[model samples]
Target: MIEQTKCNAILQKEAESFRNTSRRTFIKRLAGGTAVIAAAPYISCGKAGDSFEALKESAGALSTGNIGDEAFWREVKKQFIIDKKLIVMNAANLSPSPVPVMEILFELTRDVDRDASSQNRSKFSTLRQQTREAVAAYIGADPEEVAIVRNTSEGNNMVINGLSLNKGDEVVIWDQNHPTLNVAWDVRAERYGFTVKKVGTPLKPQTAEDLVEPFRDAITNRTKVLAFSDISNITGVRLPENELCAMARDAGIITVIDGAQSIGAMNLNMHDIGCDFYTCSSHKWMMGPREAGILYVKKEHITDLYPSIVGVGWEGAIGSGTARKFETLGQQANERIAAFGKTVEFLDAIGKDRIEARILSIAAALRDGISKRVPGVEFYNPQNREMSGGIVKFASPEIDLSDAGSTLYETYGIVCSVHGGNFPGIRLSTHIYNTMEEIEKATEAAAGLV
Candidate 1:
């Protein structure tokens, strides 16, 4: 304890000294060449001083550096086990977990497997609470409002099934919602005889109002729910969530936000957004283990929604009525939940603002590269920062986007999403792990195809 306190004191002094350092120099130095992982980036809870030192060492790779510096992100990329031979740009679908998260996941899983008993596994209950608290803090919500679940789909469905609806009650949803949020409502509407109205926005939204006005105009007296995605995987349009949520609240309607693509890639404050319900999959932008998710319900409305799946943990006690009641699904992968806490811890160590800036920087670089190199490149994603994020979608009449994904992978070992239909294009999602070098190479590969 003495040694840990001394280390923290030293770290605090160092941090104070570095406060005046230029932001550019900070990013440049931090983005220095990849260094060996000496420790995970966590210093609290009385961990050994060496652990703190190790975290500092690991963080050195991302030390004072600019987001445009390939050397800096290249170091950040080293923390993952992604293949060096491939240029993976599909953060919209999945991301690789960092070394610390994977390590704890394996270690705890092995410990559980070695002795699966009430006596040995009792700590997981506390760990689960810690997980919820970590996720809650990350999203700026109360721990009681956060429910650890399986994925975005499950969370969305929980809100869909938990809410009370009746015949002729209309739910307004954005047309660009993921199938889970879009089709799941239809399934329930079919059985319950409610109306599902999907409001459409222009493919290339010119402004935030272009995205917001459609949903704002869609609401009516019968609109009981307004469900939408903060960032759409299909069109890559980032909705004006705060405006939309406030609109719903004013209309006395519930708001359910599918944050599948927004949570980890951007800085989010659930309370500030004031949505009634929010759901996120940790596997995508969070780079946590699969089958892990988070569900946030406003404290006021927790009692109004029913638990979609109730089992061993379900209780009639007042204490049980919290968001925990919503997570009463049978036995869960406790190891993943434990690892998820580490995932949140890792992200916290890096700082969400830093992560968001890095992602946007790379996406901007990609857009600029494609426009300059690829002929007739037409972007589907809104160029405005308010209506777009790390996901960039574009197409060229000279190239066939339907087969662009396979071709990029086969020819250049680059992985990206290719969307077909009315909006046929290639989608490249940049995260902290991606590099300027990879983005440049992808642009070159795309130019050749054109």
Candidate 2:
């Protein structure tokens, strides 16, 4: 274990670099949020006397080698509070928070419950803006361009509602986009009388060019926004966002991307990504609170797009009005949302570059293990590492996987989820905390089921 406590310090330093870049507006919101965190009661993770020992303990744990270095991953496993009897392979559904994030959650909840101040009431908005600043930096976007939403559904809704196209305008969506996001567009399209074009993304495309052509082919004069999941949750395919965005830009079409699978798992820059809008929930790979999500829109589009829920003066550019307008439904898990700052801090500690590399390393191992175990496992995502993110989809031809997937966890005490979508499979996802051993264990059990 390598004590990246040094790395943690370095991460904070790097995060400080944002101080110069952050908009004055986001800084004010974050400062207010930090003040709230300061007033919050301190919940001891352990005895006060154990602080040094805890540091030493953490230092000892950090000295571990590569995650697959079996000895190292075992210790890494200790930070989580998962059921010892059950193995959790389903990070896609939700990941268990590590000690650090949990500690933050515990403290924040205590403060919100203990105090009745304007600070706590207003801090929710501030915390979200701060979180967006960090996330936007990680994803290569400006803080002003980002809005903290509840989930991918909410973020997607912002884009769907913001778009000001006419009744005949068309938007492109993949058949395999997450149901919540895909359906949001469908519901709005019907209401606004716009055309919802389902571009047929093939299960296994030969190359990046092949994977993107479906959307390109569907473009028409009325096709105003070309949107798709950054990486389809069901198929586990990483779409070419920059390429598609460039193509759309040439045609005067805007681009919207669902980063549910891509955002935290991969290092994405919104500006470099060439998309006009992007949406992702923090819970999944970001490992933040479930109801907290974010939306990014190009600065120019903010004025053009309107908020869905209109009431009580909701106006500003992207994430304007402290992003309060989008919180149409009132009084949220305020503390949980604030705790998202801690999640971002942890990720910042690990380094987004390290995390991007770490999760993909685990994903590759699972892909190899699943393929070797079941030759007939349908590999829907692009085989190229660059074309996939944290998700790896595989279904056995010899077994009825749709039904068998649920059993993979229930019987084996391994946690995972089954997908019945464009490319049916046992959708296996992993995050920073997931080691190769767990993936191997989950794979072995999955192989047995097949």
Candidate 3:
């Protein structure tokens, strides 16, 4: 590990570099001389300020090769305000925002509360655009193709309601998709007289083709849309999204990907995936503020899809001929939107590929540790990292699911998702915030339940 003083110096240097780059980008965006002067305070201070300096510093201190070093990750974990007593492994459902993101959120919220005047709030417009651009660049999409919506549900519905489906048209989806992408389609199909088919994959997939073939067989001549999750939140199955999207595209079908699980946990490029539409929530794996999400609409389909909400600024948004039309929901929480950009910056500083590798490592460790210690353990998720991401779902026949979940929390201070009914197991979705030591303790706790 680098010395503390030297690390601090490196962090400060990186932070200054980030600030300079941001200033240049902001100034370039506002090319008008008077507009730059008017936006100077917003640029130099609150909007493009030091909100993410701590995050950048922490990430910059670590060498690229030190991604697997526990010491370096421990420093990264310190950037979050999670309770010291609790081990949070539920990044699929939600994640605690890091200190930098929360700082920006609180700072902006206080600013809004202090002065609700239009003049004071004008800076948010520019900040929102910056966030849109950041999200676009992060996911490898054009700025005009990204919309800052409320959450995955809203993004899902935007495409669900936006598409022009008719009777005899079929939409093929995975059975494991979240309700927003699953039931939402059924609800829409009921009204429109369209068909919604749910396809299921093998319980234990051996290869990527095992997952892709099922969806391939489900599509037919009448299939107009192919909707599925990049990673199933329940079973932790990572689908062959690029192949699936390419298949749908070749068949002249629109592909809608619910990226609730994969967006932050994995490194993704929307263009490479070749999906017509993609949706994700920031609060889950991105660790941004709640109720903030992103909607990606392919530029060619921008005019084809209708806007779900037509509130204030609908005319200009429509006239813009971009994905902005999908974000016309009025009276948004501007503070949360601004903080979402900070969350992106935090992830970018750490590097998405490194975060993905760390997440997969912890997941594999937890899975291996549990399977070795606990007898007759059943894993719902795939063991191979190629077919999985950060999620690991398992249950022992001897222990009740609810009791195991409660005991894991109450006795071990480990918080994970518990499922009942059809899938009775505990789901542990780890992230960069988690440590190997915590996974070992959790493994012991699971064994004790037996």
Candidate 4:
């Protein structure tokens, strides 16, 4: 039971007090607040009938101050333990758990292990609902519209395979898509004889419209779906998902977005972005427990998307029916899922807007340092700070950039990908824990190639 009475009573009271509180006034109050976190451009959670813009603004980082203000993010950083010898630059792949979420995960898991059916039955169900509600609210979505999946691949697969399109339907993807997503669409296209048309989306994109224009140009009368990544793990260029989704909607195309990199790193307003489907890997930017993922399907599209995994409760009514139509049958890791709630709690506590700002700011600083310090650096991320994401990949042909493994292993002790492909370079990812000092050292180390 959710204690609906108490929650309703609180909302009612908050609503009565806010009878005249306008969004503008609330925002102004946020800007003037004396509390350190509340003083940021978008921190405070204001009013009831809650929408995400208040929260989204809270997710933005401090644009005007020192990065990682100790009084600010040290507590946030205390939530995680870093590998002593390795600086994690592979957040695009995964993230370490925060202490709060880790503790919840460990405890909940033990409880579930002790007794699966009786103890965890309602508890697991409650976690799913809360997780869905938190994520939905994060993106301004209806809680009933979200589904908890395992990863972006699984979430995307639900929409890819769930779409009512038949053989010969056209779908669009880009060269820069993560393999997990690319392969899922490919599998569907191959199985159903649908045409999968993928085009070039460059690393240093010309413009959001220009980058998306390729996908638009590939569309024909047969084009039914436009699928793409919000940011490429390979290139780290953030895509204009909303603008492109609107473009596709104008063409009567269904949109599905691979948000593994975008979800926790950027300000994601799925409603504003207008995608029919958005999927994320929680372990990445969210630092949620491993194997936890989130999927959002437009409410109208729910009944239409047949569940990818069927179980005892799946085949019932699809739209609002448990949303578990996506759930896998058999036992699940109860502890890890419980920990997922703590991750949301932690993010909520710090505020999403601040997190978003902090990440982009840190990334932009690194981008600037790399661009200025390393002449050998081939800049691939977007020039504008807004388009920049947490990932910044650079390559160099000069000197022995060949020592990537030893360079990270022995010298700087940074653990990053070679970004390993044509035009290969180092990928130094920075999160809230990463300080300006560390960034300077990392850039100075990379500048060594010259």
Candidate 5:
């Protein structure tokens, strides 16, 4: 491991270089940044104390290698609390919380249990605000623009229920949106008498425009909202969110993005994407605790959407002034909410650009190996890195994917999902914690099943 003072010196020099560059150029620096490990030594004083210090020490030893190095990722994998024997690839559904996050979660929960009084748990209110700030900074959003909620489903429903849509109003959405984002609109339509339109996305898209043009063609004078996922949970098809959001703005239509799959899987700048509302769950890719999520409502639209559930601490005439107006849903799991800060710190320490690069590299390796090793396999995911994130879906007509998934798990202890959708196939999600060796293991396991 690099010595603490020497590591600090190297990082101070890199910090000067980064401070002089634009965000776009800094992303290149961040992707190629050697300072993640160089700077890790300085975080030895992180809130979790020695446990986080040990993680920093491990990271410091990994500064010399590039982001894709196995030696580097093996150190990262150690930070997660998981069974090394099992090959788990279902990051799109859920992931194990990192050690620091898990540690703090347990500590706080025990503290809450020890003293269940109102004054004893009051500090969490400040911690919750700190968590909101951390999350907002991570996503390039303002602190006031974010609301801490239960999950993506709650955030999506908040928009679906709160928006002022009347009879004959139209909502345009993609067919591949998750059930919460796709069908929830129809349920609202049934009550409010609005028209819901589903745009058919191309099964095999050649370009980003191909994904955007369908929504462009589907918009009409009656269309009041344009809602879709930044990346589909079904086929792993990534939409051109910036262009689509721009199109919606030009048409004076409200835009909401179901960001369930994109948040921690990529280097996302919510402000750059410029949608009216966006929602995501921390458990999926962010690897935070379950039943905790974030809702982003633009500054101008805060008043336009009402709070779906009004509970205690909701002041009527005097609004909460910011996104907190939407967050007054009564008591919460203070322990899990407090631990969100630790999860953000963990990801930020690795650097978001580095995480995105590592995930894409592993997913690409898995795709190449599977296509080469397995015969008669058909890929439903977009191979272009620009049009995909970490999710990879594929199928073989000769093999029943459900049976293959079961056999692979039962025989090889490999864990992945056989998804049911328009594209019925296997979905493999690769995250930063995953190694190239695991990718090869998963690919070889599928080949053996075939």
Candidate 6:
């Protein structure tokens, strides 16, 4: 208890210092002083200190310019450790963590390695709660409503396997959901004898209603759950999640949002969306640590949903009436959890709305550049800003998408992904780290493939 209190006090002091001091001054102080982790005897100020300084400098620089200005975003780009030559436009799949997040991860990992004794590791419990609180606040959720899970896949499965779906109950999901959310439902349904129905939206949705009505129409009397991605990774279609969740609520159906594409890419409020459960990956848009994710179960539904993993903490979690029950998975990456909190801090420091706008601006530029350069290019994602996030999916009939994706990376240093299955196209998902010039180069390289 004493150690935990000391850790909390140190964390509180650091947080206050971070807020009160100027960014440059804070960076200097942070680099020169012991970090919050240093509250534990086994931990020390090391590479994480240097990385924190770089992050603060970059963040301090970004605060000076207009959101739309390229120079402003260049400062944001400096926060990342991505190579200068490579232009990575696939935040939907994975993202490179900023220097600070990586440094914390490295530092904490070494802390654990230095002393695996229970005495040395006891502080993680306090740190875990801190991360939960930070993550919940960032997403407009309660600390008790949030669980730090592995990734979106684990969270989705927890909701999938944990929900009380009996035979004959139906689950309605969007066709564009990631395979984990889509196929996993089918897999569970096959064993449990529940129905899994997929709703397909228009290829080019003209309005928000165009995206919402399909799922609205798909739900029936037997439907017990509505599952869909906030933004489709395949087509880059941003679903009207609030509308869909509201509709499901009116019908007394559980709403599960797979937020792999939308979480850190936009300003999100889980309370406003009114989902019974929400899941997201930090490795994608949040750019935190790999294998870290969030699961939010509404307070009322906490006891109803069973935990998928029952390990060390299960005894207390089972009746806790909190989302902690879901995170009873044994032996988590404690270092990543600490860094996840740092990720939320980083994103919160840079206003969520600002980040979203920067991403949308880059996406809009890419879409426009591609349309102008490649004649007869077919865009799978909606053109309207309201109907999409940062993901821009398009295909030119003249060019082979597989070859175009390779050529973009191999020749132009523009990294993108190709999808050949149902959604056959080239996908370019940009983020704050990307620049308009890189988008232009990608546009030209893609056009050259045609």
Candidate 6: where are CA atoms >4 Å away?
Answer: 1-68
lDDT of 2 by residue, 209-240 (tens): 98778888999988988878888777788888
What TM-score quantifies how close candidate 6 is to the native fold?
0.88
User: Over 4 Å off in model 4, which ranges?
Assistant: 1-71, 315-319, 399-402
lDDT scores of the candidates, listed in order:
0.81, 0.69, 0.83, 0.68, 0.81, 0.82
lDDT (10s digit) by residue, model 3, range 118-145? 8667778888898898999999999999
RMSD of 2: 7.8
Candidate number achieving the greatest lDDT relative to the actual structure:
3
Please report, as a residue range, the 10-residue window in candidate 6 with the lowest summed lDDT: 41-50
Give per-residue CA lDDT, model 4, range 1-450, as digits (tens).
245555456445444533444434533332222211222222112212222233324335545433346455544554456655566667888788655455455434544454455633455665566667777787778887777777787787777777877787888887778776687788877788888888786656667776877777788989888888888787787777878899889989888888888777676787888998888988998888898888888877877777767766654534345455677545677556655665676676565676788888778888888788876567777767656689888876763557775676578777677756655777767776666666777777777656
Writing each residue's lDDT as its tens digit, candidate 5 over 40-127 gives 4233322222344555555555553346468767777766756667888888899888766775665466556756778667767777
TM-score of each: 0.86, 0.82, 0.88, 0.81, 0.87, 0.88
RMSD to true structure for each model, in Å? 9.7, 7.8, 6.9, 10.7, 9.3, 7.6
C-alpha-based local distance difference test score of model 2 = 0.69
Candidate 3: 10-residue stretch with minimal lDDT: 33-42
Q: Model 2, stretches more than 4 Å misplaced?
A: 1-76, 119-126, 311-329
The residue ranges of model 3 lying beyond 4 angstroms of the native Cα positions read: 1-58, 61-68
Per-residue lDDT of 292-326 in model 6, one digit per residue for the tens? 99999999999888778889978787777788888
Cα displacement (Å) at residue 11, model 3: 24
